[model samples]
Target: GAPVTTALDMSQTQALTRAAAVGSAQARAGGDVVPSAPFLIASHGLLGWYWPVSGKLSVLHSGQGIYYGIVPEGDAGGDNAHMPKSLWVVSRPHNVGSNADAKTARRNFLLKVDASPTEDVHVSEGREELAAVPIASVFTHDAYGYANEVLVADTARGDVLRYALDALDGAASGGGRLPEDDEVKDAHVAMHLFTRKDHINTLLAGDSHALALLHSGGPSRAVLFDKECAAQASA
Candidate 1:
């Protein structure tokens, strides 16, 4: 059968088209909620979700049946309005195959670092690390208000950054682990906040930098994850 194609503005349109085919095959069984996908979005066009397995871009939704729209900024085009040239991943905030106990648990923010497979990252490794610095402050903050704490990531990826950013010292030792760090020594200074995500949009919204602690079966001590990111704009 002939494939459906679109004349999208994306220069990588052909590549993305090929990826869609891959995504359809990898779609998990049933509609179970997924926390995150191992694939990272390569769209890099203002916004789109990408499954690492197939490297396909996903349509973005604001949830509540609303899709995030692009607002063109004069010559910069639609991508200008949103954060352009950033890391992204496909995340599922609902449904859990193993942890069915959670319907609305933390959405999984796929990883920015293309490490080993999800299975390998989970059992093969013991600890991981992720570090990010906002090049600027968010003009708008979430209900949690200004995220004001450093976190040690737990999941094997970035989807959990926002959730973990608010806590100074706490760890989720099972699913995966991130090295916990302290709050910024200079609070007065304006910088990007280190955080986590439980959804696709959330992952793309925050600092794009993230790492994972893959365990290939070791003595279970502690893994170290850290990094600093700076957006072009600063608050």
Candidate 2:
């Protein structure tokens, strides 16, 4: 695949979609030499799909009307600055339409996207379904990212969920969501590994590890998880 040298907007997205559609037709007709184009396809409708082309890209969309189609990551230098090294979660706010009811019922959910270091981007197998957790009143702005760790403040649940990137990679193979155990076979439950006070509101990734910030009516504090602590917990 060739590198894209131009900026991509909605217009470009539509054009790419057209091209993919043409290629799909050719493929169905059993034609050889179908033009290969990479896409990070996403759709907000109930029934939408993404092409399984081999490349590094991602698609962000939901049934609530958010669409961020296939796009390359990184800076103009193609350095992948915009890409994620492990999985990252974002609190997504949505109000379907301008209707008063919709506006009044505006809500937020945690959208988790996967990533890897070797590729420009990482996506689930289909890239159609996403790993989402309903977070009614989370600290949307409070998130920490480390090479293989993630911490998110779930104010609604009054606790913080920690994540292990490799575990997520393992889970993605079966589907992007975390497994029923919350802990993958060899990985710990990101949600259960750490415990914090109710309404803990922030997090920051340290230079060598991850730190979670919690706030109560009184003072705010940071909790650092170290190897000894993890080992003790496991034991």
Candidate 3:
């Protein structure tokens, strides 16, 4: 029998194809050729693919999902329509497998990469440190389709933190000074939004009005957080 061959396309709907050699093993032993039958495995499957701009691939420890959103042009520039977008990635270091320790000394990171039109771009990691592990994240937007804030859910702390987009972009650009200035601050402040007893696995933001947090460790449930509820709680 010939060996099985498999191919996977991450972006395609029919993602996987497995081909098995036809005819008996004795035919190949007798110096005979045989064709192969290809079978398609069909299902609703999701796969993620990333192509690094650089030739090297950098691995993230306990890396979660990658989110894309419009970068709001707040105070940084007057042109709101032409503002660039960005990619948000969250990672929790020292939080998975045998290397995980309860007393591990490391900081979780929420990284932002500017998706500029031109080749000029920079990657920014938030300096506002979180000792807890971040499990999921999402970007909330305003009415004009610009990102308002990014919400990160840390299941280790059982809470969510919201970071303003303007502050994040400002810190990444180093304001009006040189980006290499040590005097330039990169710490983006985060506001504590809410907490939960169950572990949050994912975050979803609705059309400028609502957010949904999905909890999945125990009894699965989703909690909706609306703007009215947030305003009321703040009051």
Best by lDDT: 2
Per-residue CA lDDT of model 1 for 1-235, tens digit only, reads: 1112122344444565679877865675556445345332222222234445454444332231111112111131253333323221222332333223222333333222222223232232211322222211111111111234322222222122333332212222122323223222333222233222311122112243432222224321111222233212222
Q: What C-alpha lDDT do the candidate models reach, one value each?
A: 0.27, 0.42, 0.35
Candidate 2 lDDT for residue 218 = 64
Q: Give the Å shift of residue 32 in candidate 1.
A: 13
Judged by lDDT against the true structure, how good is candidate 1?
A: 0.27
Candidate 1 minimal-lDDT segment of 10 residues: 135-144
TM-scores, in order shown? 0.20, 0.39, 0.41
lDDT at 235 for candidate 3?
Answer: 37
lDDT agreement of model 3 with the native? 0.35
Per-residue lDDT value at 71 in model 3: 25
- Per-candidate clashes come to 29, 3, 0
The residue-level lDDT of candidate 3 at 77 comes to 30
lDDT of 3 by residue, 1-235 (tens): 2112122233321221111233345446766343221111111111112123432211211223222222223231333234333344443333342223324523443444332222123222222211222212222111112256665554544444455555555555532322222221333222234433455555555544534344544655545555434534443
Q: Mind giving the per-residue lDDT tens digits that candidate 2 earns over 75-180?
A: 3224545543323344334323222232234344334443322334443332334464343233333545555654555444444445555554555556554432
